[model samples]
Target: MDWLTFAAFALFAVFSGLGAAFLLRRFGGSSGQWLDALDRLERRIREDLVANREEASKAARGLREEVVGTLKDMAVLQKSTLDGFGAQMGRLTNSLEQRLDAFARQIGDLTKANEMRQEALRATVELRLGQLQEDNAAKLEQMRQTVDEKLQGTLEKRLGESFKLVSERLEQVQKGLGEMQSLANGVGDLKKVLTNVKTRGTWGEVQLGNLLEQILTPDQFMANVACREGSSDRVEYVIRLPGRGEGDGEVWLPIDAKFPREDYERLVEAAERADPEAVEASARALEARIKQSAKDIAGKYVHPPRTTDFAILFLPTEGLYAEVLRRPGLMDALQRDYRVNLCGPTTLGALLNSLQMGFRTLAIQQRSSEVWEILGAVKSEFGKYGEVLDKVQKKLVEASNSIEDISVRRRAIDRKLRGVAALPNDGAKAVLELIEPADVEPD
Candidate 1:
């Protein structure tokens, strides 16, 4: 029994023994039998109590030992868990630090890109403005020369008539000036459009889309594609690479167009003003921007096995594309670090053409495989036809041999008839008797 049950039994025994002893002593005082019975009961109760005590002690000792072992195991488990947790924390800390460093580097590159774009835009604006000024100056000089020539001619001819004509010419000059002002306003509006970052991006996307439409079919490329699983962010375009062999799925090749026009403008402005320090600064900035763009493209779009290992960064304008190429180690760095490919309009067109050719070649190979299978089937059918022809030829030969045997039998019968005829009347009579006729009486 359990400890509680054993204790209950022992308590009852003790109470019963005490009650019986008390009654026996009260009812049978001085009786030897009653005293003996009470003594026996007491002895029995004492023996049971001693046995119960020993069992309880043993059980208690066992329970204590079990609890001590459990505590030791728990302590060991706790230590192991703590060690694992500490190692995990260390790994997490290192990963966090590396991520932070990479993020900081990316931020620095973005800042440089912004600086470069501003410089390039400034330079472009200055150049356009200078050209416009030169054109205006030339027109003014031409007008001045025309006026001087008209004045000289008018002085030698009718002075009043010349002055009236000069006033009309002045009105025409004013009209021309108004037109020039309108042109200048248009240029200002264009500059404003280009200055805005969103407008520039929109323009670049449009240009990229137009080029793609011209070069490839609609099925060949998809626009505004979400490249990653469980992501809402979209890339501008992705080319669909046709799969080779049966059951192989199509692969994606992502293309992102980036126009860092603002930095480019800043660089142009600095160069125009002959500021060596600013130009160098802009150059460095442009380099950083290109690098950052490549890195971003690689991170966002280039997923190996799903997409190509490398992604393309398209620069719409040739000048920007050329500028990126001119940077020392820039292209190599982009390819090595980011798995990014930089392509301008012309180069991208060529690449698309090559891809198209590859697709055509794959199609041809598939078709060839199908044709070979058909040829194999045809060969199998031809073999069956040859077997049928052999069977038919064997039947024809058996029929010919039967016809020859029948002809030989007919000739032997004819010879026997001839022999009977040549034996004279005696032989003919014997033959006739052998083929006896029916009796006349029966008819």
Candidate 2:
């Protein structure tokens, strides 16, 4: 069957062939017997080979069946292990899903609780804010009412004071108006009196007299004098001056007052109306009136040897006097032709002062010789008085010598009596009365 059995059978067959050859050689046999032996041996080898092949085929079949059975058993065991693993995975998956669901529910509850707490806090805060606003509004309204009451009282008091002051001022104004009305009536009466020419003349004369009284002594001037020897015209006033010669009578200086009121009024009216032509005409008329008055005064009063060569025409007001002076060449012409000088109240006062000084000078000159004669007589008497004064001085010197001798004797007596005691007042008086009763008198 295997190589070893085949080799053994081959070796045995060779030996048998050899042995048969030898036997043939020794005992010589037939060829047919060897052939028949060979045939039998070949047949045995074939039977053994057939048995070995059948056993090999059976073993191979048994081994193939055993391998198939072991493979089946292993497959069943692997299927069981896979089924257990699949069941465990399914359980782990379900537990994880349940835990996740519980966590989600807890989170939802916490969120609801937080939202409710926030809503409650918001409502409480809003209620407190509304209460605060209501309290503030009530306080503001009360403050406003208090301020209004104070302002109303203050305004009413101020208005009352203003009305009282205005009423007092009105009363004062009414009183002033009444006084002004009375003054106006007095002015109207004066105007009526001035319209008459005789009354105007008398007023001028009175003003002249007042000025003379104030400035000049009564003996220095005379009123209503007929300065012209042969004329009936009398001047208002004349000042007395010394004559040129010692025996000559006192000289007179005539002063007459004039008022050209109508002409002056016309000029003032024209100036107020701003009419140049009317003003010029009125001024000329005033100038002519003044010249006529000057001529009248000169002709009526001025006389040489009795009065001054020139006379003064007195104007009652400075305004009239100034107007006359303003006329061109008017003052010079009046002085040259009429021998008259223009003067107002102020000018007349100044002229009188100058004349008073002149009178003083004249008086001093007239008494100069008498003053010299008195001085000579006083010189002669003064010499006699000096001789008498010398005799009196000699007598005074002798009296002084005698007084010195008496003082010396009195001191000597005082020394001798120094040791004697003094007497009391009553004892000394009794002793003196007893010694000289006729000489002693009562206290």
Candidate 3:
């Protein structure tokens, strides 16, 4: 039994013994019968206590047995459950293994099929590549043969054309050589002509005359002019300038050509020889010759009021002019001392053109008053013209008014004759003849 049941049984036995002892003590002075009854009661109580103890022990043993049986039943149930769960797990594992094997087999089959397809595709590509290469080779060989044949023909044609062109070029070269020989002979003749002093002077004069003729009108300039009074020193050309005053006569601008060919040739030769001393000597000689020529022109041609204060000395060749210009301060010296201006062909052309412009300006200045008078006359005539136009406009207005009056009279006539009916052509003409002649006359 449990501790509580066992303690209750022990307590019952102790109380029974104490109660018997108490009765014996309290009834000691009375009789022995009271003590005997107490004894019997204690014996009965002890018997009951022993009996209760046996029942509690039996109940405890029964309870322990029930608990052990329940535990055994639970252990059996758990074992069965574990067995069922293990079996289910084994079946599931077997099913998964079967499915995985099938899946692996499918994967292997797909891999074989893929490999077979790749091999077939590779074989087909190889066949196609071989066929294509064979076709390309044949085409390339055919193209090469065609190109070779065309190239051969083209080369032959080009070669023939080249030969023909070469022959034509050879003929042109021969012709050019002939022209060059003639040119050389002409150059020799020109050199001979230039060697003479008179011929050189004539050449310079001809060049100067050509430049003047080209730039100036014939009437604008004079040939071989004696610029000074009672002087026989005639200049080659002279351009006439307008006089400064109305009473003053025309001024002359003298241009004379000079060529010191010998000195110029010597300078050219010394430069070509690369001899500094010879070049200096030749240059000085040429400069002296030019200065002497300028002095001669200044003395002979320059006459103030008759001619310009300065005269032009013309150099025919630009090379000679350039050499003269190269002489340091020579142009300034000539202009300051001799009153002579140096001119090449180009410079003389420019000078003549400037003079021509000056002449035109002078002509325009002389005619400006006349032009103004003409404009004044036109202005006066324009006023009279305006008056005449006003009269014509008035006449036109009167005529227009008369035409309107005639239109009204014609309409009235037509209204009166409308009731008379139409007439034949002869009758109409007879009627017109019978009408007043003044009515038919033109206004």
Report the poorest 10 consecutive residues by lDDT, candidate 2. Answer: 1-10
List residue ranges in candidate 3 displaced over 4 A: 1-188, 273-277, 407-443
Per-prediction TM-score to the true structure, in the order listed: 0.43, 0.55, 0.52
TM-score, cand. 2: 0.55
Better-scoring candidate (TM-score), 1 or 3 = 3
Name the best candidate (by lDDT): 3
Ranking by lDDT: 3, 1, 2
lDDT by candidate, in order shown: 0.85, 0.84, 0.89
Q: What is the lDDT of residue 182 in candidate 2?
A: 71
User: Which regions of candidate 2 are displaced past 4 Å?
Assistant: 1-186, 432-443
- Across 307-398, the per-residue lDDT of candidate 1 in tens digits comes to 88899999989888887888889889898899888999899889988888887787798799788999999999999999999999999999
Clashes of each: 22, 0, 0
Candidate 2 local lDDT, 1-443, one digit each (tens): 55546665686678667766765675456777766766666676667656766776687678778888888787787777777777777786777778777777877887788778777777877787788778777877877787777777777777777777777777777777777777777677667757877777778889999998988889999999998777789999898887899889999999888888899999989989999999999999998898889888987899987999999988999988888888899989999999999889899889888888888898899899999999999999999999999999999999999999999999999999999998997899788765556776779
Query: Pick by TM-score: which candidate is best?
Result: 2
List the candidate 1 regions with Cα displacement exceeding 4 Å.
Answer: 1-189, 370-443
138 Cα displacement, candidate 1 (Å): 59
